[model samples]
Target: MATVLLAVLVAGGVGCALVVCLLWRFHRALDRTPPDVGAFAHSAATRTAGAAAARTSSARMTNLTSALPWAVPLGTSVADSCRTEDRNPFLGPASWAPINCVRSTVFYLAFDGDIRTHLRQLDAVLAEQEWVGSGSSLNTLTGMATWLSQAGGDPSPAASQQGSTEPPGSRPICLSTTYGPATQKRAVPHGGLGLRLQVAVAELPCTPSAETGDLQTDGRPEKSPVEGTVYLTWHPLSTDTVSRSAYTAHRYVAALSLVDGYAVQSTSTTAPPSPLTR
Candidate 1:
């Protein structure tokens, strides 16, 4: 009986030692684990924040573009009004990296009238919107006309002129303006300084070929027989990509630090240090 009792006591002591050993090893493992930067970036909170920012910025830009006054002549029939939207994220002349802070939208409309008259009207409209004219440029009509022809409905005669020195050489005028924040305030969290508006007006002769006409039998309006075309684009003036990138990186690092700290705290508190480990 005494021998059996001694054996049971020995077994109990070994079991307790094994338990303590396991607890010590677990604590050590937790301390040795390193924080994963990638995991923090892919965390739910980070993803949600990114998605929300993109949606908010997109909606704000859409509203601004929708309010613009698109030029269309009265008592003159027109067709195939092509409008294009694009986002400009490049930082500088180098086009090194893309960022989410800068956004640009382009709109095209064709009308029949004097280019100066249309430009004056647009200028007046912009003035009412509190936009200050910054600068203007004059480029050959061929460049602007060719840009309009990409709409794909009909080919314009001006678009056909690649480098031909022809009569009636038209010089398209482009005006750049900066918008004041008196009326249209920038959206919060979008990192916008303000808005810049550009207006490019030119004269182009759009006449579709027989082949192109046959292709447009779907009763869809074709881009043709218009006296002139106008291109309008707007973008935020603030392009501080470095600051935005730094801010984003800081957020990820903070999140990771928080997560790692919490993990360590919870693991440390899981159990007291065993006397055997001590």
Candidate 2:
């Protein structure tokens, strides 16, 4: 009996050791995942919205790190990449204020072009990269499209016209949201955590229609060429432990705007042009 008891104790001790090792590894993983919001802030400030959005978004991401400890895994490689471009005022000698904001690129998509085609192409390019999420939801795509439509400002009269072939005033742009597999609990609310990526395309009003004499031979108003911005966001979602009944999602850790086109041009070196500029 004593021998059996000793054997049981030994097994229990071994089990405890194993559990401790697992806990250590888990915490280590969490440590690796904290996002470098500083990097995101520096990059975002170079865009059209200016540094305000960057500052706000970076603060939100920092808050999220405190909540969702394992949301964004900034592995050694990613951290190194961020450090290489670390332009944080708190850390660096350079000021946080932007010196010169320049237009990065501009491209025009045909008014009636297949936006989904471009989105799919962009998706392909993203898929080739290491940071992108593996899982995709059609529902998320639908949600993004709706959000873009509302955010793009009031729909033109053409959009209001029923059964219109040209999507009323503007063309349809595609948006996609992709997510990575959750490393912790399931992605479902209650107790889930993971990384999310959102990409959206939208048309910008360039030259006024009247200025460009945008009319077809049939006297129908020709829709303006679609000049749009490609918006990219990285954020995290997590369930609240205190209120297990609900979830808490965080703001974007990184948000970037890129002009879409075969050739990108900077219109000005002194100030960034409006994202809508063609």
Candidate 3:
């Protein structure tokens, strides 16, 4: 009876040790597992935000292009060619320039105000000009209004704040127009207008503020102010005919810089080759 009791006690002790060992192993495995929950969540949120921003930017660009319908057909083709060439050697400038080529003109307007408001003002300014368009012809004013209406609402607050200040009214806005005359149109095999114009806007880095004190006196680096640019291009359509002359082929460009809600720098130029006799 004593031997049997000793054996039973030893077996029970061994079983308890095995159970403890298994529990320890399980705990160690859990500890080795990757803790990526927070990282994964952050990555997903960043991707979503990036996609949203891209879409907003694209929409704004499209609206800007649509504002000038007469220039769209030709400008789009040239812009596409440029983008393509930039990506691949499929199309060279020599081959692209002569095709439906026309003398083009680009115009720029820069000011300090809300982007939407500035666009509206630009539309009004263009409407006052007789060379933009007439009855049954492409009207820049109507085109701008239509594009704005289709855009639905105001630009996203985040978009408006890209390196820009708050209070949307204080943001700098730039407008550009590229005009080409029918005289610059390239003859097409088919009977149709072969005209082209292109416009683009880019946000450039701002200039750094000038440091007042010596480097030893001021250990911190000076922060640069935010700045951006708006680019525009114009081209004649491949099919457009050289009928009656309208605007000149000369480029009209303007630039404006604002400081403390005031125009600090303003410059404008209209190139040679005066407008046609109208």
Candidate 4:
């Protein structure tokens, strides 16, 4: 019994001593830092907060893209993949790829290019309600909408309906994508930003093709490919400069996946982090 008591005392004493030593070290480190340095760090955080406010700002739209007449995709994932790619085929400078496995109508998604570089840098926070999160919608839409209005041509509803809304070479919808089911498009205003350029794709007939060989090369799993008409639009109010260019929007087909609900977000860009993170 005495031996046990002695051991407990020793252990307790050692723990108390260790805690005291750690506290002392922390105190010393804080004391060693110059007062001016702390002031600068606080100042920096304050500035970052202001910048964060600018990124998540929101605006209401008078028109809704879904209200337009277009073919909407069915059974969720089995459709819309092509239209999603078609609407945002490239997203700035990234390349669009279909990752559908054979035997079932299922394809995963991927991208390639400089825009992919920017997307990697973006802090993507996904949710069923908002695809790219509220933080990104404001920063993405403002410029996209304005770009289409000023420089976009005909929206190139489809290959058959390719017409220049503006003079050729004067900067129309710059990406190599098509927007079928033309309608008056607008981004809905959510208190926290939502996918502004939302589209409703309809079912479209797709046949297995010869070039589908590379699609399954990745060896993901057994699944088929899907193609559908997506009814999405560009946010005329994005703050990002890249989204504002027709060239970029043309390449900006937001890579979407068929998970439950909606693909509710843009893969083209993401919202900045909170001031605290910065």
lDDT of 3 by residue, 1-278 (tens): 99999999999999999988887666555423222222322344323432343343244335544554333122211111000001111322111111110112222222222334444554554444312333332245335434544555444333344333334332122223333224434322211123223232222221111111111123332221211111112222221111001111211112211000000111112112111121
User: TM-scores across all candidates?
Assistant: 0.28, 0.23, 0.24, 0.20
| Candidate 3 global CA lDDT score | 0.28
Ranking by lDDT: 2, 1, 3, 4
Q: What are the clashing pairs of model 1?
A: none
lDDT score of model 4?
A: 0.26
After superposition, the stretches of candidate 2 with alpha carbons farther than 4 Å from their true spots are 1-113, 130-136, 139-166, 169-198, 205-278
Arrange candidates by TM-score, highest first: which order?
1, 3, 2, 4
Off by over 4 Å in 4: 1-66, 70-76, 79-132, 136-142, 145-161, 170-258, 261-278
Per-residue CA lDDT of model 4 for 1-278, tens digit only, reads 99999999999999999988886666555422111211222344323543342232211111121221121111112211112133233222223222111101122111223332323232121221233323433333333434544654443332222232322333322211111111213332221211222221110111111111113333322222323222111111111221223222233323122111111223233322123121
- Residue range 94-188, candidate 2, lDDT tens digits: 22222222111111112223334434444444444322444444434444555665667555433433333435545334333434323323332
Model 3 ranges with Cα > 4 A deviation = 1-101, 107-110, 134-278
lDDT of each: 0.30, 0.31, 0.28, 0.26
Can you give the lDDT of residue 25 in candidate 2? 67
Deviation (Å) of 57 in candidate 1: 8.9
Residue 223 of model 4, lDDT score: 23
Better of 2 and 4 by TM-score: 2
lDDT of 3 at 69: 38
Per-candidate alpha-carbon RMSD to the true structure: 25.2, 22.0, 24.5, 22.8
